[model samples]
Target: MARAPWEGDFPDVFVNCKWKSPDAKIICLADHGLYDAAKGQRDMDAALGLLDDIVLEKTVSKLRGLERQYGVKPKLIAPAAQVSESNNALAIGYANWLGHELGWPVDENIFQMKDFSKDKLNGWVRIAHRSTFYGEIDKKTPYVIVDDVITLGGTLADLRSFILGKGGRVIGMSTIASRDGNDVRIRLDTDTQAKLEKSYGSDLAKFCHELLGFDHRGFTDPEADRVLSCSGYVDLRKKIVRGRNEGDASRSKKQAAR
Candidate 1:
């Protein structure tokens, strides 16, 4: 059998983005599944179709609702267009779709990523190399950053900080999914957090925050332990394999009963 695209050279998951504290203003249509599906299949058209059919209209509704609730009109910000890769292409398509629906001009090329590949660890989000956003981003204007997924949230954090530094305000962030859980709080209990903090020292705890938008409180004990042990990358493949095994076991049990 052919291996899934996610099972390629890099581990399917890794900590890349810095965390931005969870806020209520942001509206995500779906979770990270959209990103995975798009990248796995290497098909931007199908991904955009899913986003358009299942997520786009609803996303617009949510945006209108947010406008009504906050009285703060939001503009869309996305990573610059990179048509070569599947995920970047999806980002571009999403931005264009949302821009067209709302009649809001998208600052599509506001930020240009120096590196093409996303699998790198250290320079995943190079703030220093990022050129100043040439587009007109009115000061204090509320902007919502869009992405396919929010795993570690390092990229979003970097984007938020960059916008803020440039005199723009980031009211919220929207993405297809949250890597660990949809909620933006610490998932770990107090005792577990304390244990991991003591065992791994303060850096790991900081990493938990930098990688995800939440602090150490967001991780469960097992999750924290997994972070510590996965040294090179966040090994979500284990979770996937374990889930498959459980599913197979469940089917076997059911068949036996029959």
Candidate 2:
């Protein structure tokens, strides 16, 4: 609930990005669990698995346990990811599970990661584990970007650059859980804004949620403690992203046919 960069007059989920649009499109969803990332350890999952930890990958399992015990499913039951895998795999895994649970087709695509050319910027830009990608983002394909957990959202920023850079737009974004803390400023880049004007002829954020529903879960203080009580911490952000690069390869296939 930090003060957003673009607060008034923006549609449902639009905001501003200092680097890009005066009006950017920003959306948010929460991570499914919580973990204390090890200091000096860039590896989120591995760090959590070390000695002196408690693991709580069964947030959903506990909910399921409660549901079976009580005989009814909660309307918004979000589960924690049990393993640290690639981002694509994590997303597909979640989508597959959701499909099984909801009985629908769920597909996902991740942004490609590319190192910025030294020619493009001054000194080393603070590239998160996730970096901006160069590629095409298209649709009629049903997919959402997924991550195990969302924090400062370096990945989301990378995604925004990729999707907009390719004359495409974000349908929606999904995640397992979040740190429950962020100060993101959302806005549409020039490319995304132009695409919005061409495709919808109106505001993009107003219709995004209607087209692709937000799938996410919030961490309660108790649930947070329960999760942190365990030693299995998994930041799988980069690894999860590495998994999705394969899916994005097909973009060239589609573009070739175009």
Q: Give the TM-score of candidate 1.
A: 0.49
Where is model 1 more than 4 Å wrong at Cα? 1-47, 56-59, 81-87, 119-136, 179-258
TM-score of each: 0.49, 0.32
Name the best candidate (by TM-score): 1
Q: Residue 161 CA error for candidate 2 (Å)?
A: 2.5
Q: lDDT tens digits, residues 29-101, model 1?
A: 3333454555455466756765664353445665566567668667778655344322455555665666677
Error (Å) of candidate 2 at residue 123 is 17
Query: What is the clash count for each candidate, in the order shown?
Result: 15, 24
| Root-mean-square deviation per candidate | 14.7, 17.5
Name the lDDT of candidate 1: 0.48
**What tens-digit string does per-residue lDDT give for candidate 2 at 1-258?**
111122122121111112122232422221112222321223344323321122123432433443454443322211112233222233334444444543435433343432221112211122212343443335433223444444334344445445544554343333444433221223323343343335443533333223212101111122122223323323222323333343334434544655
